[model samples]
Every structure is written in structure tokens, then in C-alpha cells.
Target: MLLLGAATVSAAGQTPEAPKQAPTFRSGLDVIAVDVQVIDRSGAPVAGLGPEKFTVTINGRPRRVLSAELVESRSATSMTAVERAAATAGPPVVPTLPRVVFIAIDCLSFDASASRHVIDSARAFIDRLPPTDEVGLFAYPYGPKINPTTDHAAVSRNLATVVGQRHVPLTQFHLRPAEIVDLSAASSSANARDSSLLESVVVRECGDTPDDTCRRGLMLEITGAALYYEGQGNAGLGMLRSLLEQLTGITGRKTLVLLSAGMIASDTPGGRPDISELGMQVGKEAARSNTSVYTLFLDTTTTDKFQAQVRGADKNLQAVGRDSEILGRWLDQFSGEAGGAVFRVQVGSGEYAFNRILNEISAYYLLGVEPGEEDRDGRTHEIKVKTKEKNVVLRGRRWVMVPKRGAAAAGTVSPAPGPAESASAAPPAPPRRVVPADIQAMADAFDRGAAEFQRGLAGTRDLANLLRNFRGSETPWPNAPRRTAVFALELAVAALRSDNQNARDEGGRLLAEYNVRLRQPGDADAFECAWLWTEVTALEGLFMPDSAMLLVPAAIERCPREARLHLAHAIISEQRWLRGTAGAAEVPGILERYQAAVTFSETAAEARMRAAWFLFRAGRLDEALALVETRPPSGTDPYVLYLTDLVRGQILRGRGRFDEAAKAYRDALATWPNAQSARVALMTLLLSRGDRQEAAKLAAAVETAPADQFDPWWTYWLGDYRAYSSIVAKLREMTQ
Candidate 1:
């Protein structure tokens, strides 16, 4: 329901001002996109420079300048022109998608006037028109809203709604240990509720600079599962993932324009607060989805000494205080891997995070090239873009290495090439040899397992137990050196992707069983099976028609040959989680697994994706978005990246950034055009914006879109009314 910008695309023969013909690039030439925050030694954004003043480099080597262009914020004309051109860019040079944008708002410390300025700035951003753009909008505590495929009028309406709802409970809340059964519980559960609520009310509700989320929540209260208790594992990441699975599927590229108070925590009375757990959970999922997250730290201050501040010119990271340090860590860890930058508000300024947020969301570099080769092993390649500029900052992938196996196995000839080479040796590998193995077995096994699971797993409880017992606490089953839980879960998830009874019934049952064993804690290893089940199940939704079972096992345990055999063991103790529902046990198992890989922060992007997978299933979308956005990626991580985009898109849409949400969905579909939820969002945006032709096209795409693993949750994806309201509101404003 998120509204979107629907400014008409520039038509042919419209104005004499239009360039007679798009500047032509030479054939057989390589093109790259570069993002710059140009400045002097003082690090300010240097403007007014032309293309001739820049020089590009790669690996300390000089390179030719194929294309050079600058993007001033809100230059919708240039933005649209670049995007349209890139969409049509063909041959030796393929167009690159826009970088993801993350925005942060600090209601915990801002005053009313400042908040209003921020929201107004956001409104102005929505009012600006563009073509082929992707964006996402988010406000903390209220969950993110998303829109897909849009126009300006839709975005304008959403902006008004957002501006009006700044201080409502949806924006800030009473964090409880668990859902209250009655009004009495709300009164009696004093200690269980977050004491911080008092501060939140005073600072965010009454004194806020902008209370966008809360203002909207006054009349229409948000009612859903209250995420609290250790049992919840990681908030409500599952709902987020289900939503994202579709959003990321629509938008090929996405920018998250987020406004948050940096209040991702749980303060227990007279006990150590456990926000670290929340941080980890959030971080994991954000890494998995390949969602780029940039922050505009508002007025939040961090207590941890890990804080580091660089002076800011635009006042972007000013009040961000020490919180920017932590958020920066998250952003750099994930987006940095892809060569993306994590910008913030100036060190101590109050110019409104919204202004900088709009600038980042509206800015990007455009370039393109047709993929030179096609590799079927589902390999994700790391991409590095270089421009012909001196000291210019470039933001894009470091390399793209999607092979039959995960990224680790691709381009193994790093320090040394093949069998014999030195640090200064020959090229990593010839471009022609880029395509690795076809990975047919992985695809086939996944397809078949989903078919079997959809059809159902066994004939009796004993059979279920037998399946459960296949990998015991101390036993390492077939083809695995240690725990087979993840491997088994992977296969089960693959099966669940299909509509077969075994997949829905048996795979589901196994998930439930593992949950019982790992939901709390029993023996130390009870969570092993549970965690694997969650990840595998989620993957089923990613691979689609192809079976993920074949790759699931290897993916779960793709460590170096010398790594420990028990690397896959769940971190949760059995005594804590051994007594949950057996039928849905996979969910708990997944959490345990995700926590087990917490150290994967030091590992590769794929590991982060795996970690993020568990966070997503654990039902922690915000955290998941944060984590998914952290991973070093090679293009998109298929399901994780797609779902992340989809979820982020929806979240932004619901928040009244219609244009942004639509962009996210559209970008998701660029990579996974077959995603139905993405299609729905896009069509919805188009229709609401009165772009009948595009809306019809989007609708038709949905009708004819290919099947995907997320099909089962299509209903849930579009059920939320917030999304609709976002669109309706934005549509009205933009049309005005």
C-alpha cells in the first residue's frame, strides 16, 4: 500500500531541450559506475566539477574513463535520464543497478520543530519526480512499509501521512516481556515493560522533532504478535522475511530511507539488558538479504566507548553521537563488502536527518553491460567497478563470482593462481573461464526434496523419530563430518518449496519436531536440528522450482577442510529449548543455528547470509534487514537478497514513502521478476498512481510471472492495510 512517485516519463519529441540523441559509448568497451563524496582533504562533498576533472583506478592501476557524470540531489531529470538510459544499455557494457539507501531518524532526542522539518524534507523528496528509481522508507518500532513500481502522486500522499504520524505509539512503544492477555496485564506487568517507555514518551511523543509513526498510530493502533520473551528468539523476523521475499523479488535495486531512534533494545529491571542479542539477530538477517543499509543518525547517543566520529559537512551524522559508531559498524560490515558507503549525519548537527536521507535516496551512478557469461551453479560473483577518476570514490560490487557452489569455491586462486603463482602472479582467471560447474545436482535435489516434502515425509511417529534420529547429538551422518541437522533441514526446505503434500506436511512436521527439541534447551546440542530446519525451510522459498536439498547440506557445512567437524552445532543449550512444539521445531532450530554462527561476522558474505537466514525465520525483520544489508555480496544472494528487498520495500511503502517502496519492489523484480508479491506491489503502485498502462503491464506480469518459492505466502504479503493506506494517501498528495 506504500505510495510511489508516478511522474510521467519524459516522452520522445517533447522538448527541444532534450538531448538530440543519447551520448553514444564505443562498442567492445567496458563501463563502470562510480559514486563520489568529492571534497578537499577536509572531506566535504565537492560539487561543480565536470567529467574531465576525474581519474579512475583499480588495484592501484590507472584506467580509461568510459563515462563520467555527477548527480546533484533532487535532480530528478538527470536521475530519470540516467536510469532510462541504463535500462536500455546493451552489449559489452551492461547497466548497473542503483545502490541501496538507509536513513535514520532520532525521535528519542529531537524537539518538535526539528522533527517537523525532517518530515517536510521527506515530503519534498517524494514530491520530486523521477523514472526507473528504487527506494524504501522505514520508521522504527512500527515495522517498515513498502510499495512497488510507482509514480510521484502516490509518494506525495504517503509523505503527508508520514508527516502527520510522527509521535504516535507506532513510532515508539512500551516494550513488554510478552503479550498481555488483558487490560489488567498492562497495568500489572510493570517491571516486565521497558522502563525506557517513559523516556520514549517524553522525548519522542511530546518533545520530538518529528513523530511520523506515532502520529499515524493515534487512531489506528497497531495490533499483531507482541515480540518479547527469550522464546521469540529475535523479534518477529519471519513476518519480515515473508514480506521481504516478495519485495526483494520486485526491485532489482533498493534504497532504504529509514528514520529510527536507535532503540533496538530490551531493558530488564535490575538485570543486564540483552540488546546485544537483539543486535546480533538484527545484524544476521540484514546481512542475508543483500539489502544495502545507509543511516542518517539523528539525535541518538551511544554509551559504548566503541564510538568514532568523523566531522560531517551536511550535518548528517551530528546528533547521531556514538550510535553512528555501532550503526556504522553494521553498515560497513555488510555494505562495505560490496564497496558501498555508510553515510551519516554530521558529528553534532541538527539539520534534520531527512534532508541528507533524501539526498542519498535520490543519488546514484548509472552504467550497464550484458553479462559476458552465464554460470548455472548459482554462483554469486563479487563485482568491482572502476572509473577514470583521481581520488574519486566509487560505490559498487567488488567482484561477482556466482558459481555452482557458494562464493568460497569460486576464484580460489587468490594469493596464488591455480597450482603455481605468486602475489604478483597472473590474472585470477581468464574472463572466458568465469563460468564454473553447472550445479545441476544441487538444483535437482532441491526440486525433488521440495516435491517429496510437499507430498509428506513418513507413515508414523516412529518414522518421524527415525528421520529425527538420522543425525544424533554425537553422530555425523552420511557425507557430513559433523551435525547433519543443517544438511537435513536444507533438503527439507527444498522440498517445501513445491506444492506437494510431502513438502507441506512432512517437511513441516520435521520443522515442528526440531522446534520442540531446540526451542528452549535440553542437552547442549538439542538446538542443532531445529536451527537447520529453519534455514532449510526458508531456502525452499528462495530456490523456487529448483530443489535446494542438494545444495542445502553443503551450504550448511561449507567450511575449510581444516575446520572443526562440529561447526554446525547449535549454540543454544538443550536444557533451555528442549520442550517446544515438535511440528514447528525448525523455527527454534534455526535461531540456535543463527546464534551459533554469530562469529561468522568474521567470515564471508555467504556465512552472513546463512546467519541472516536464521534471523529472518526467527521473525526479526528490522534486525534481519540490518544484517542482510551487511554481507559482502556478489550481485544479489538470490532468495535472501530478493526477500530482503521485498520486505524492505513493503516496510517503506507502509511508512508512506510510496515512491521509495515502489522503487524497492521494482528493483526486486528486476532480479526476480517472477515474485508475485513484488508484482502485486508494483501493480498496486501503478494503479494507485493512475498510470493505467504501467499498472496493466505490472498486473499482466503478475498473471504471467513464473512460480517461486514464496508463492505460498502471497496472501499474507498483501494483507496488511497499512500498505494500502500509504498508497492512498500518497496518491492523493502527488495528484494534487
Candidate 2:
């Protein structure tokens, strides 16, 4: 959405004369701009190519090339005096398009040494990049990220910090002397290979004829390792995909340099789904965002004595080699699909790989191709560019995402008009509105009241008084004023929470009025009604479970594609059932809603945790454990980790897995040591198991913890209300 432009103007003392015609430059879904790099035999950029020399195709059909301009970087301008003189005699140079590049380091994938090498190479690449290029940095799997900027030094400094921060352990899985085995027959499948290797090691350690206990241990270890790698792969891909989605909003082509040892992309038998599918999804997203992914595959193999001794030296080397090959193939496919190249970075070869990448990206061609109607189906289409010039090579994106018909028109900027076009063009149309002025005024007042409540400057009494005289909109606003409805519901909840009788009365009255309005023909927006119904039902259920139950089905009918609404429905239904107002018949529906929320909301960790809690409460220990064991969204959010562990601990305890439950509780405390709920839970569990000493230590530690420390578990049932202040602030900003 960031648009950069230039205009030629007259001197300050004189009146500016306008041009004869509008600038011919055009962009959008109508004109697909494909960045093509045409290099000669020597790897030098070949310039001055006209549209006639280039042929472009989309989905195997030829497309007309509207224009072809060479976007050369400043570093690529080096030439002999004779060549420079020849260029001066040719067409004028086009200004370079702003280059946006991101260096993403997968901290979890590399070892400490490999990480340092990746950092050094990235730093060197940044140093050699043209100053005009904006560079960014992302240390993946919950590491720091710097937004794209021209400050290369800042990016380099950030890159340098990732050297020693690699998550790769010196020893991933330890094998005893008896566990040593040849893994030559291991399946090529990444997950299968790991399973095979781990199972073999575990079996050998258990003796030639393993017992039931040893067999159980083998299964547990193999399953645990698979889950760990699967989680890691998902986290890495999730982060990458998130970055690509963010880049989709920015204008121009972007370059993503991924520095990783490897990513696990294969599926485990009857276990986790194929992570390779997610990897391909990431590739598609990168293409959709017009990003080229250049992968720098770091070699993570090590020769430490301990690793070799645990697994036979030959077996160790073989496993590492096989892993590298599998991972390397994935990297190649990932990069190639996104119209980029991969370079294998061995020790001392980082600089060379980076240099080649820099050279490839230094200069390129931007071809404006007129897409066919079919190409505008809001899907990525295969694009190929070729030139008739001899002894030359062409490199461009293999896929381009064409915006859906009528979608590109939104927020698109047309080229500046010249004097003649400006004088003849019609005036712009007036803005449209569905909501009446009075409704907007009410919404604005509620926003101000919410702000006041947030600042502790006033209560909701004034807002209640204002709404006391006001009924529903005079004219049916329908979907209009959703923000106003949300504001009203928020204020109503605040009033209901207050001690004042008048405030509570006003809140009840406002809810009644809106409830009537919502039922009126053409007066309700599906999404707005869904939200209001869910909130109102929850609020009413606080005192009147029967009335809330009456409104549940209507709310479900109006609910749109929103995870929060489904979550709210599930919570309210559960609450009503718990109060004995609803029967067991509703339990299935409640669980269904929870499952829907989880299915629809990939990043909703709280939803997953709550769903797990609900299942645990229902004594579905296995399902609850499975839900909580899945990796929470990739982040450094202490509360999410804490909550995940807490829920897992509760589930495990319910299943009588006391040791694992204690460990889970301790892990939760590690994330938030002052978390009283987790500490108390752990202490209670330990005490019941006769571990009085640790229980006493835990109980004593609570007194020394900070009084102001907040335990997220206390408000776990409040759902999103835990973030009420921030949510209100965000709503205010959004409405404004």
C-alpha cells in the first residue's frame, strides 16, 4: 500500500505549467509486473532489452508485454568508460525500484557454529548490498525481528546477536553403548527415518528380547521425538508464513533470504500430518506475496566425540548425511517453487554463496504483462519469461498471484494526471454512508465513554443516561454501526458490573432495546448480531441462565466465520449446562463448538487450552492431553506456555499420570514462577504423593513472590476479558 512517486515542478517564482497528457505508468491486477533477471554467459546483467525481445506467458498462454524496464541497482552500475559512453547514447536509465530484503535465520535449525557462520554471511551480504536497498532481519522460532529499513548497520548488528543463540542442542538424542546400530536401511521419509533410528536405539538398549516395559519405553521415546520434531517444523513454517502474509500488504517485490540448517517436512505414520504440505503452503504464500525465497542451507553436521560414541561413528555420519539430503531436497523445492535458488553453505563457503545471491539480485527487469481474464481468478498462475537474445539467461518468478476481479480496484492508485487530463476529468464522487448521523453520534459518544472508563476518569453512568432517551436507529442501519453495537455491549457489560442500581437498570434497558432492534426485519448485521447475541447471552447467563439458553440457537444462526463467537457459544452453553438449566443433550453441541473454534482459529492458543480444559472436565483424558500437547502458536508469550503446561498437567493428573503431571506443573512454574495457581497445584500434587519437603518449599516460596504478579489461570474462564483494557483500546483506535 506504500506508494512512492515523483513530480517535476516549476520554480517558486513562476506559475507551474501542466503537462499535455497523463503519465502512462499503470499497475494493479490489470498489469502484472513480473521481475525478470536476464543475465549473460558471464553472469553480468544484460540491459537495454526492449519489449519485442521478451516473450511472457501465463498458464501456458501468451500474454502481451506492455512494458519492460530494467531496474538496476547502484552497485551494478560499474562499467568501463567506453561502455558508459555507449549507455549514455542509449535510452535514459529508469530509476531503481526500492529493494526490500529480509534475512530470516532459523535459530532452531542450526548448531552454534553454523549459526555463527550464517550470521557472518548475512552481515557480509548486508554490507555489500546497495545502500538504497532496505534490509530487514528475522531470527526465527521466537527470535527478534527488525522491519525493513535502509539502515544496514542496524540490521547487521541484529544479525550478529543470533550467532550463539541457536536452539540446536549439542546432543539431540542420546544412545547408550548397547543402543549403537547401523541405520543404513532407514526409510527416506524424514519422520520415518527418525522413528526407525530411535526405535532401533531403544530396542538394542533393551536387549535382543525386549520386555513389555522396554517396549513401552521405546514407543514413548519414538512418539515423543516425532512430536518434538513435528512441533519444531510447524513453528518454523508458521513463522515464515506469517512473515509472508505481512509482506503481502507492502508494495513491490520482496526478497526473503532463509538461513536454516534444515526443516522436517515429512509425515509420521498414523501420527502428525505431513509437514511437507505446510512447507509447500509456505512456498505458495511466498509466491502470493511476490517474494523470492533464497535459502542458504547451513551444514549442521558435527564430529564431537560424545555424539560419535553414543551412536557408532559410521552410523552417526550416515544418519547425518541422510538427514542433510532429505532436508536439502525440501529446501531446494521450497526455494525453486518461489522462483529462487538454494546454496549449500559449508564451512568457509558462506561468503561465496552470499556473494552469488547478491549478484543475482543486484539488477533485474520489471515486465508489465497484460493478464487474461482467467488469470484474475484470485489464484497464483504459472508465469514464464524468455528472451530471443543469444548467449543469455533469463530468471523470473514461476508464479504470480493475480487479484480477483474487482478486488484490485480497492486502494489502487492511478498514475498522476497531466494538465489536459486533469482539466477534462470529472470530479470525484462523494463518500457513501449507511448509518444515520444520530447512530454515528451515539457510537462516537460510547467510544468516548469507553475511553473515559479506560482512563478511570469517569464511570458508565453518563453514557447510560445518554442512551436512556435514545432507542434504536430511526432508519434501519442493518449492518451499519457494528462498532456502535460493540461499544454499546461493552458499556452495558461495564454498567452491569457496577454497584449502582440506576446503572444496572439502564444496562438492562439498553440490552432489551437492542434485543428488539436486532430481531426487527433488516435491522441486524450477521456479524454484529452474532457478537451482540454472544455477549448479551453471556451477560444474561450471569444471573438468568434460562433467558441466555433461549437466545443460544438464534446466536448460532447469526454467527459468521469468527472463532471468538464460536468460543463464546461453547463457554456459555457449558456454563448453562453446569447450572443444570441445560441437559446432557447440549454437551455434544458444546464440544462441537469448541472443536469448530479450534479448527477455524489456528493461532487461538487460548481456545485450544479452553477446549482441552472442557474435555478434561468431561473425563476425556486422552483427547484433552492430545489437544494441550499440540504446540501453541509460535511466540515468547509466557502466559500461553504457562497455560498450555497448566492444562496439560491437569489432564495428566486426571489420568493418574502423577509424575508427568508434576513435571508439567513445574514447567508451567518455570515459565511464570510466581504463578500461584500452578505453584499450588504442583504443591498439592506433590503433597498427595508424599513429597512433603518439596511441597513445603513451594508453599514457602509463595510468600516471597511479588504481590503485583498476575496469574493468568485465575481469569482463564473469563476468556478474552483477560485482555479487556487492550481490546477496548484497540476497538477505540479501530473505530476512530
Candidate 3:
């Protein structure tokens, strides 16, 4: 995806660090330019200083300054000048000078409610900007949705679209199935959590020597987990690198204002590695492009007590602390390398941060120095700038990477030596760092719990422990919000399935907390349909079906086009219809909504699967099979695979194809052996076919299986109660 075109040396003779090979410049001049910001004792920017007041040092050697001039932020007329100059480039070559600014919003790395504040504050900053400032607003990987524009209305429209759809969790790119398997193994030997059956599947999938597969799998798994937990910041970092690449040919000051909660730390406490190469890439590019990257950590503070505990305060502060450490290290390295200083703003002080950036960019002095012949010895020259005036402090780049002699003629820059290429190569990269024993154990426990949940093989306690351990250890923020939310809802649902008093209480509490937050002024308007679904799901998970049913009208009014809301309504309606509280005439309306939900949800595959399940339970065998067949045959998700197979069996059984239904159930069990639905269905199919011995064996396994793992709610909903009661009677007889 990173396509490198004909490499061009900047007018200042710098080449960015290439991804693979070392790069050399092809410039006639050896000028090195650094953007400097100087301020007096009172914290005000010091301007109007001449070239004579400063000294430049490189690689322990002093260099003479060629030019020093203040590049104050200019008006829109100056921006037009740069456009004209770019238009007349190649031969006549009029130099272009425009202050370019990029504002990247990190929607993936912050809470949804808090992100509203970030967007609003950013809008305020944009409104106050002078017409001269051509600003580009980006929502992480998606866009500048509106590119650098001086038009206020354009910015508003683009930003509104961004915030309007903001609550949808950004989908993480899926790793190849083979890669995910290997990644799990490499996370920890103990954490592998795979049974003998799964191991056999992996071996079969690889179709080669298991030893080689194991080795490669280990390497890939570590890398994959790092990528997984890092979230969308991965894409944001890529865009930042690409931005630097684009800025290379442009002339004059460039600034990128990165607004977000913050990126995850490379040294994050868990064994998860930092897969992002952005910090290093950004630093090198910022220096080469003479651009400053100013990060604004949006203040995510809230006064609502329930919101604070459930969605806001403690978590936001934790993010601040984590990002401060991460940003301080990387931002300082890149911005300082580019002679731009980083500002860590306090909560509710986004305006102040913007002001600091404007002040620094508007009044900074641009100084240039011509490197000596020795400076081009194919090594980096460390540059330091200082002033003699009392009470005046100067800030700028401390070093520059210079191309080797005639390496310029090659017209490419090789990647700077990584830790491996350096003398410190003896130590493994952080991603390859050995996962600690305790960390590994915790990871294994989490995976085991997840596997148990996936197959309906877990009890209430299993889910409770997993949820508690996850919250206590991993501490989701900026990295794993979606993952956390999903797990929380699952645990609450599992509690309701088992009739666990404490678990149901926990589920009710989560719904109550979300409901209180939703009722706050303007909160309902800002709520994403996904958030609404979470609350509805919690209500269902707690067995408050009537309460969940009551929420449908308001939810539909709020997000009229949302398919998930319709799906939720369908589930509630179906439950009532089965309980005989609703008429058969109501079924048609419910079916229409199910069809609508399948047609409109972004996660259409899941919606379709659910719709198919409902139809199977309703004895609409042909319709269920037709619906399931429409979905793509391949899926990377294990849960989806299991559900697809299980539903196919149910439909087959309804059609009286007992043998084929039996095969389908076995296939589903093969996909997820601990799947209670598959086991129960297979047992009933055997009984239907008069295979009593096999039926009795399966019934015995079901009786012995962990109590929390089997959810009678789903069994009843799926409409297999006759077979379910028969199996129970058989188990009771054998026990008695």
C-alpha cells in the first residue's frame, strides 16, 4: 500500500528514511533548514531576531548560518502565491511558501460521549482561524473527508458527517486465519488454549510440516496481537507517514495538529507489542519535510457520576497518563527532531493548545545552514542551536541525517538503521520481547474464557472471572474499547442465561448506568444506534424482555434507518409471540422488520444469520435455508462459522433430512466442539432417527457439561423443547 514514486531531494537536501534501503540525496546544494521557536521569560513568543544572534552546531562541529528569517503566518494572499508558484514549477521554478496545516481527529482512540466534546472544541478552533489558514480535517483513516480548505461551511459539513456516524466501532482489519492461529500460539505457550481437535485443524490447514508451521505461527501471533490491540491508531500512523511524504516537494512551514485521546504506549504493561512504526517514521519525515507535529490531548472530563464510572472519568484520566508518557517520548522525538515543540494541554483547554500552536507557527524564525564537506560523510549530523541574549531560550532540531557522498545520484534513501541494524541488535525488538509469566497466564485465562463463551461451554462463574480479570488487568482505553464493551455485554448475557443473581444484578446495573447517561440533555440526540443496541442487549441479557421491548419506539425514532434497532425489535417480538402474549398476525410485521434489519445493517452477515435462526425456529425451513445460503461462504470469525453450520442443521432437521442434519450438527461441533446448541441438536436428531444409544450418550455428556455453559433460554427460543424435555427425562432416569 505504501507506493514510493521517483524520490526527490528537498530544496534543503534532505531525504526521508526509506522503509528498506538507505537513501541518498540528489541536490546541488547542501543547505540544512530548521524551523525554530524562541520565547522570552514571560512565555510570550520572541520575534524579529536576526541571523547573527544564533549559532548552529552539527556532530560536535560548529557550522556557519547561511540565512535566518522570521516566517510569520501570512494571509490568504500568500497561500495563493504558493499555488501559483507550484503551478509554474519545473524550469522557471518560483519557490512556493505556504503554511499548510493538517488536523487529524482520533475517533477510534476515545470514548463516544467524550468525542463529542473533542469535535465541538475542534470546530471552535476552526471557526476562530484566520481565512489565511488552509486547514484539512481528517477523521483518522477515513478522510480529510474535506481536504485542506479555507471555506468554513465545507469543514462543518464534513465534520458533521464524521460525528454523526461516530459511535460505530472501527473494524479492525482481519488477519489471515492461518496467521491468527500462529499469533495465538506465540502470545504464550500456556495461552494457546487449543484442544487436541483444534491443533489437528491447524495442522490440516497448513498442509505441511507442523514444526515449521509452529515456528512461523509463533512469530505471526505476537505481531498480530500487537496489531489487534493497537486499534485504528495503526491506520492513523500510516496516514501521518503518507502526509509527510506528500509534503516533501512543498516549500515553507507545515504543521499537523493531531487531536485525540492519544496513541497506546509501545511499552504497554501487557505482552502486547507495539506494532506501529509511526513514531519513528513521523520523526524522520517531520525532519525531512520541515513540518511540526503538535499533538492536542482532548480533555475528556465529565461531571456525571454514572458516566464517570461507566464511560468517562477514571478511564479518561488513565488514557491521559498513558498517552502523556507515549506522546512525550515519540512526539518529542519527532517534533523536536523537526524543531517543533509538543504541548500537553489540560482538560477543557483545547483553545489554549490551539493558541500555542498558532503563536509558535506565526512567529517562529526559519534558519538555514550549509553543511561542510565532512558533514556529508554518509552519517547523521547532530545539530544544536543556541542564542546569547539573556532571558531568551531557542528551540530547534538537534540533528539531521545527511546522505553519503554521491549517494544522492542513486535518488533513494535507505531506512535508517533499526535496533537490529544498530549495535544494540543483540536484544530482540519489543514485539519479540519474551512475554512475562504472569502476563502470559492472564492472557491464557482470558483466551480460555473466550473459547468457552464462543462454544457456549462456559458457566456464569467462568464469564464473571474473565470479565473481572480483563477489567482488572488489560484496562481498556484508547486501544480496546470495542473489545471491552463486547465482553462486558457478553458476561452480562451469560449471567441472565444461568439465572445467577449477582450476574443479573451486574447486567441490570450496566443497563441502568447507560440509561441514565442517555437521558442527559442532548445525549439521546448524540447517541449512536450501536450504543442503543448495547443498552437493549443488556436489558435482554438481564431477562427484562418487557423493558427492552418498551425501548424500541424511542430508539427507532432516534435512529430511524438503523437495522440493529429493528433486529432488536424483532427478537423482542418473537419472544412475546412464542410466549403467546402476541397474536399470530403480529408475526408478519416482525418478519418484515427482520428482513429490513438484514437488508440495512452494516454487519449484514450477523443480521442475516440471526434472521435465519428466527425463521428456523418459526418452522419456515425453506426460507431459513435460502437466507443462510445468501451469505458469503467464507468467514474469518469462528462464531459466525459455528452459527452458520448450526443453523443449516436446524433447517435440514425441519425438512426431515435427519442424516444430513446429523452431519451438519457434527460439522458445527467440529467448528466449535463445546457448542451446546450443536450438541443438543445432534442428540435430538439421533433420537428422532431411533438411535437411542447415541442419543443417550450425548444426553449424558450434556448432563455432565458445566452448568453455566448451557443456556435453556436459547433452547426454548430455538423451539426444540420437545426434544429438550425428552433428553432431560432420559438424564433424570439415568441419574435416578
Cα miss at 348, model 1 (Å)? Answer: 12
How many clashing pairs per prediction, in order?
187, 1, 12
Q: What is the lDDT of candidate 3?
A: 0.52
Give me the displacement of residue 693 in model 2, in angstroms: 37
Give the 10-residue window scoring lowest on summed lDDT in candidate 1.
Answer: 219-228
TM-score of model 1 relative to the true fold?
Answer: 0.33
**Segments in model 3 whose C-alpha atoms lie over 4 Å from true places:** 1-30, 41-43, 74-96, 116-124, 127-130, 147-153, 156-227, 268-277, 301-338, 377-382, 398-736
> How do these models rank on lDDT, best leading?
2, 3, 1
Candidate 3, residues 470-526: lDDT per residue as tens digits? Answer: 322322322544433444444445554555554443443333223322332232442
lDDT per residue for candidate 2 within 1-736, as digits (tens), equals 1111123223223344432222244556567667777777556667777778889889999999877666555432344556445433433334444678999887767566656766787898899876767898887654668988999998888777775333321222353211211221232236543665555664565666655555443343333333334444555665677677777755565788998877544422333213566577677777767786789887654432234434533345666665556556557767766777788877445887787777666667777688898888876788888998899877666877677766753222234344355446653332222455544565555546655444431433365454443332222333555555566566566666667756654555455334433342233454555555446444543543333433444455555555566666677666655665444556687778777777674436766787788788877879888888865655646777898999999888988999999989988988887799999999999999999999999999887778888998876656555665555555445444
Model 2 CA lDDT for position 566: 64
lDDT for residue 217 in candidate 2, whole number 0-100: 35
- Candidate 3 positional error at 726, Å: 40
Candidate 1 or 3, higher TM-score?
3
Every candidate's lDDT? 0.37, 0.61, 0.52
The worst-scoring run of ten residues by lDDT in candidate 2 lies at 1-10
Query: Model 2: residues >4 Å from true position, as ranges?
Result: 1-30, 40-43, 75-77, 80-93, 164-205, 267-273, 302-318, 387-393, 404-736
